[model samples]
Target chain A: MTPVARLSPDEERDLVVAAELGDHEARRRLVEACLPAIVALAGTFRRTSRIERRELVQEGIAGLLLATRRFDPSLGTPFWAYASYWVRKAMQELVADLARPVALSDRAVRVLATVRAARADHLRQHGAEPTTEELSRSTGLPQAQIERLQAAERTPHSLEERVDQDGVAVATVGERIADPQAEWAFDDVLDDIEVGEVRALTDLLDDRERLVIRQHFGLDEPAQTLRGIATGLGVTAERVRQIEAGALAKLRASLARPAVAVPNET
Target chain B: MEPQGTALRHDALVYDSGDEWVELGAAFLRRGLEAGEGGVVAHTRQGLSLMREALGADASEVRFVDVSAAYTRPVRTLASYHAVYAEQLRRTPSLRAVADVQFGPDPGEWDLWTGYEAAFNRSFSHLPAWVLCTYATGSLPEAVREGVWRTHPGVVSGGTWTRSALFEEPERLLRGSSAARRPMQVLRPLPVVDGVEQFRELLARELVAERMPSARVLDMLLATSEVFVNAEQHGGGVVSIRVGRADGRFACEIVDRGAGFDDPLAGYLAPRPGVGAGLWVARQLTWCIDFFTSADGFTARIVM
Candidate 1:
């Protein structure tokens, strides 16, 4: 492996200045020069998993790129000094992501769902939502332990559970009655049981639609221009507009439902 | 003795005042350099422009020492800068005494200044003498007064008023001051699932309102949303959000109710394949990002 060469402070500053001024070559040079420092910093986390090292380095590189573009030479400091914070922060985030589980086991996910249902049922049976303390008392678990367990489950409880409302049902909680806009947004992505609304929104669209939506909404890529998306999609710019409108309409229709029926009516 | 000798020879001693003093100190340092005698000055890019005009054509080599102040104590920044400067001085036999200037006039300000002074004084006591100057002029002291007033504006108006106004005009001190703004907006507790969307919307609105470029704001919103979503999916949807401005920067925080990982630093050090992009997206989006997760919860903050 070739050893990474460290740029002198002035060279680094020059690269940063040029990069900030939209000089592509200088931006590339800045990334190349800082790559070694980033790698060495990544090395310090040797105890981390191999996955973490790769992620941290990549994150560090991204940070270095951003630092280059945003770095103002007028600030009177070397680019490296300003870049260090972003680099380390990127590295730390990589470590944190690794430590966090990306995909829960199917069984664990099911268990969480069941636990949430059971908790809600227990609250309904008792005529009041069980407090963490009460749940701990009834379940014979430490409060902290219960809290931890609950977090792992990620079950969202409704506001009604906390109040003394007996007539409200779980299905009613999911009803499309109260706020039409929220309900429409919620319904548009509710079809896929496995994924939540946001993820479902992604799944609902075709690749072109998804990319356009993501770019236009600034979801995935940096902001996109209408012309850019239109060119990418091989459609007229007006067609791009039609596509967006069509997608939003479909989403709204899929997610929207008639207002809830009044109780005991039909 | 060798370490002491090295400390004495350095042209200047640099200290990290954390984010707290970087701006004020940089301003002071720029002024000092502008009154130049070919003195070498080093700081972050944010502080560099002010000193550029002061850099003489025949100025001695000016080296910038890059250091992290996030999650570091003010004393730590000072200590690390001192170490770097001392080492450099040791290498240069020709350089004479180091000039150290203390800035700002906050109450605890003395603690950091005095500590640095004591360390340098003790370390370089045996060497040839150098001047240690302190500046609390204009906005430097104004920042300190603002900090005090935010907490105790009444007391400041009473006895401390006269002392605070001496450094700068009272109206200039108070006008367009960050102290007038609320310190932090305490958001209602949000579930990790729904809260992430709400937080993203709020961040988007703020970014648009502030006229931050669309690309930058979008990047931050996406990265933050991902973190919050992960908190809900893995940590049990326990999360909180807070936003505020401090020290001339905008900050947003996303806290999750989850025991921090067994090795908090390990995740960033070694991430699972293909998942590294989320963090990369985050880093690309913000000027500074900090993460703190413990047995109880995780807090990720972004500064722009």
Candidate 2:
């Protein structure tokens, strides 16, 4: 590892002045000194996309050079703070050029991180997964938004993608054991909860909802199409789809609860 | 191909029963197919199967597209359908379609789908096509049901086709429907600036402070800059700019001194190279760009 050059406040000011005054050696030294910090800054801006760390660092360096020409020490804004703005802007523009299909906003990423933290805390305290409502209340995100965020977090993984456990590769994602009971996995909303808890959640739903949820996900029964479910329930397929959506929402709301108060049967 | 004398007949068929929809849809397509008009059907799997059963021997005449797969993006879908319509019109003077769009589940997605429906009226107006958009009111949300009435100029129901009494003009309906949505929560007023660069910096500070990703912030900045330039060039210059947060989405409202353009479909069509490219870019970058007029002035509110 290369030792990063650290300059004190006055020294940094002198270096900036020297670099700005056509001192090639001083500019080279300044670039070398800021290299480590630039790399670290690039790390935070890293995305899951194909844009590389090296490319981002190059963009940051371009910004640093621009800052060297533009910065006025008399402005009283610290060199690091002023440079950081230019650095971020350059990298941001590069990413935006490549980000035609915009990734989730930083707020969404932070919210998801907060939800994970809250979920961990809930599991630590309660010894079970938290319901969407509990997570929403704890994180201050709306439940609907929480559900949507969770869905968005799922980037489609290749079947060959490795599943890791505590930094160790365990198995491929496709190699995971499937529950024999569910022909069509009830994997969208209530996948995190255990089967027993799922049953408890479903118990809180009315007869129609229970039927819809069961038939839609093929819980213990053969997976039936929405059209088939609609015929069996004596309703339109669209109505069946709506009932299934409502039932899943109900299940998501009631998940991990000790005892859910069932709604009055319609 | 020569331009068809008649405009596209866009109608909504709001039905509760599956069997009835299949019957009406089959009849609509069969008549066209038998008359040597081109036929296309894009619908949910269930709708397709039911329609196929109803059409029986005649089902082979029409092209089938899976609605779930095809209707993923509004802009792309419009482009694809435009191509299909252009190709069909070379051989047949008229085309008929059963377009039972599978609307997305969330509000943002719903906006895209509804916007596509409204934009379709203008995009396909010159094509000799009859599109029947089916809405299963049995399970559809009230907002979507209302969107159906607003977007479609006519309705076909109970074996009768009639002009919808509730049908507002497409541009009016799109603008009104968007304006009718819950007002964004304006947390604070952002400074109105003269040049695009200053406005960009100001908006960037607000969005970055809200922790939006930089790329997204850039897209918003570029888009807002486009609108800012448009304001200067046409809308008598921007008067005020306000930033707001609503349902975890960021909204920037730019109020201008000029009356907003009357064309509702103005930034909607995928712009022809030299045409209104700025607003088109703005519309592409943001979730939506809703234009409104008030006693104060005309406002273009962008949500991302």
Per-model DockQ: 0.01, 0.01
**How does candidate 1 fare on TM-score?**
0.26
Docking class of 1: incorrect
Off by over 4 Å in 1: A1-266, B1-198, B262-277, B293-297
Lowest lDDT 10-mer window, candidate 2 chain B? B176-185
By lDDT, the best candidate is 2
Kindly provide the TM-score obtained by chain B of candidate 2 when compared with the true chain B.
0.67
Tens digits of per-residue lDDT for model 1, B1-304: 1221222221222233333234433443344344331123443332332232233221224444322221122232333444444444444322232232423222333333333333333333333222222122343454433433222212212112223222322233323231122223543333333655455655665655544544455546655665666667766675566665533345677777776443211112111122333443344335545666543357666665
TM-score of each: 0.26, 0.44
Task: Give lDDT: candidate 1, residue B266.
Answer: 18
Candidate 2 global lDDT: 0.65
Residues A193-232, model 2: lDDT tens digits: 1222212335667998877655554444554777898898
- The list of candidate 2 runs beyond 4 A from truth reads A1-266, B1-6, B14-16, B30-37, B52-63, B69-94, B101-123, B137-153, B163-166, B171-222, B240-246, B261-281, B293-297
User: What are the per-residue Cα lDDT tens digits for candidate 2 across B1-304?
Assistant: 3333355889989887887788888888988887778788887444665575467546656776754334534654665576566556656778898888766434444655777788888766755689999888887888888778777888876768878777766676666545343334464577778787567657766766665543355457667877888888888998888887753357888878887776667666643323454665566556567777765578788876
